[model samples]
Target: MKKKIYIYILVCTFVFRIISPAYISASTVYYDEYVTVSYVSDISGTSFPSTKTSYLWEGEHMVYKFQLSEPTIIKAYFSWSQSDEVPGGIAWFSKDMYGVDIIGNTAAISSKNKYNLILLEPGTYYINYSFGKRGSYKNAYNIGLSIAGQKVNTNTLVSASSWENPNVIRTDFYYEGFLSNLQPSAHYLFSVSSKSYVTIDYLFKQVDNLKADSAKCTLYYRNGRVIKSQKYDTRDTSKNKIAVLLEPGDYYINLSDATAPTSLYVIAEPRTNTLTQSIKRYTNKDVTVWLDSSYDHERALMVSSKVTDSNIRSNTVWKTSRNDTCLVIEEDFFTVSENGWYTVRTEDENENYVMTTINITNIDKVPPTTNIVNNKTYTSKSITIRFDDDVSGVKSAKLNGKVINYGKVVKAKGKYKLVITDQAGNAKTVVFTKK
Candidate 1:
């Protein structure tokens, strides 16, 4: 009975050890506001960093909990006053209090490795830091946290005040930011009120001897959908420019650098509709229209027309022009020689289009014909004259060089001069005798 009781006591002890929570030596620190650090531990001897924003403690491990409202890039910098007084440390990002490491040890902290740039999605996150081993000389280490893109307002739309004049390409709508080993990217938010062709121009220059290997810019819809993205080497001439057609909506621009610190100047300019006149009319002359030279690239121009009793073939022309390049379409360039309705449309590779209609009218060489109601060679009553024009409509009529209504009767019984004109300036004169 004594042996059985002892075994039962050992079994109960094992079960209690399994059921109880494990010991956690790390203390948790919560940061609710920008650059405000709050400590929750009762340890009295703990000290803080020189810069009140950083955490300085001699503990072997520490955990920081912070909430991010939007996707952000953060920089975590770890340092110590004396390199020999502290051992190396490691920091990682996790989603929960003790969740699986999302980014493990990419932020290894040592005297040589002082900082790490972390891109994080919106959520509550934990920064778990572990000083590899306490050094012989018990000294406090420091961990500083900062937001890389803090200068940008993630929720607010960049002011469109400078975009008031959409016709002119304006660089006033721009964001200037610095990138470094600590902060390698910047984010910006903007809105487009209408469908437009937008141009993004950037001036990226090296701030240090460490030249960036590559630079990239990505455009995203307000809903987190990627609209377009471009990446370029720093040496590429086209690396500084991006042009795209965007629909009306909100968007995000993320500019990133790789391997070096850079100074960035980004501009977003929305090009408005250039075709002001939708319809143009010309009579007895050649039709000519100038293409918008704002976009200095090649585009497809389609011309379609149906002329009366003519088999005119429609054609598409590719026009390439630049600031220094001139492309001229000669006079009377329409394929149709007769009068008809023509449409000229210009389209880009993205299928964005602008169009104009041309109404061409040939010369009406034939004058208006007149019909006399009283055909008698000698008439004692008044006579009525009716006028009609085929091509151009009848404009006006005059009797004896004085304005008179068309198809009106004349009561005077004497020789009279009747004149009629058409819309195309074709005039007709008649001599009649009303006796």
Candidate 2:
């Protein structure tokens, strides 16, 4: 019997050794990972009510500490029971050194609170948790911890800013998922991608309720590098629209309106360019063209038809419904002088401008060359355009102010022809002489 007892004790010891603890390791953290919110407590019972305990509230804020070895990109996410009552909000973060919020509202989860952390350097960080500006904090909330890409069982904590008498943690009660910080009529999310340009689209509201008075947007890059800005006023609540020019890299965008409305939604898409900028063509006659302009100003084009006001006719041969980086300059017949100068004026909406001048006598004075070979007929409404050479800065072709797809039939004639423009706004059009 004593021998049997000894063998049983040995077996118990082996079982204990094989089973690991519920909590994972203490050290050995990886880079670029995601963490979620795990534990939450409402101390004040005001903003974070017990009724919303099991589910995450949009107003509840939490903080967490983590160590980093090197600069890393951290993407954060959240897991919770999806409930019908919770409205969505934004997530934010701050470095551990300073208490200031360096990156404000980096990501917004209007429908889902999941977010990606803004890029951070190697060191310790204490993330700021809030449901936006909607409600106040009533108690303490906890966020889940993950390092180097592994989720571990560790304690997350939230405390009042001060522990003195009348120590208030701003803990308040709230319904599940209510984004208290999001303004009813002015709420928006601004995302500036690696390539500085910003794209904003509406979200989370009816089509008509979202409208802006000025349609003006601004972007901040490399810690306050201001770029180009523009203004527009329209009721078109479409999918996505580009805002303005910015330097290439990460940035922040802000959209605002003078007149307040109801609910507003906005998002930013990364700036991308598939074409390069260059000079497209030069008129044999005297004419100067403005190439590309920096984000701060508008490119200009000046033409000296040298025709009398009575004889010279002016028209917008080509204008883009969508903004184009490169365009071609085109004008109808203009009598030129042997030693006269034709100029193109490039000016932005802001009234900033530049000018380019060409001397008429310089070139072998000749009109833009063309070829009518392998002539194709228009079965459907279409027009054909042939270029002399691979024109510089003529990245795209447009007809009647609308961008035309390459190899697609353009259904227009005469004044409505294939117009090309350079980045400098030097433009040209190949008028279709109807057969």
Best by TM-score: 1
Q: Enumerate residue pairs that collide in model 1.
A: 379-435
Instruction: Give the per-residue lDDT of model 2 (tens digit) for 343-394.
Output: 4444445443333344444333333233322223344455545533332234
- Report lDDT (Cα) of residue 378, candidate 2: 41
Q: Which stretches in model 1 have alpha-carbon errors above 4 Å? A: 1-89, 92-106, 109-128, 131-171, 176-197, 202-216, 220-227, 232-240, 245-355, 360-366, 373-382, 389-393, 400-402, 410-416, 432-435
Alpha carbon lDDT of each predicted model? 0.49, 0.34
Lowest-scoring 10 consecutive residues by lDDT in candidate 2?
Answer: 1-10
TM-score of 1: 0.50
- Per-residue lDDT tens digits for candidate 1, residues 1-435, read 111110101124343233211112233343333333233222122223423234445534454566655444444555455463345565666665442334423455555445444544446666655554432225565555432322222222222212221112223454444343333565666666665677776545442223455677777776778888777566764656667777677666666764232233334444332322222432333444434434433343434342221211222232324321212334213344445555544455666554445555654557788885322354757666788988877888888898887668877777788888887677888777877
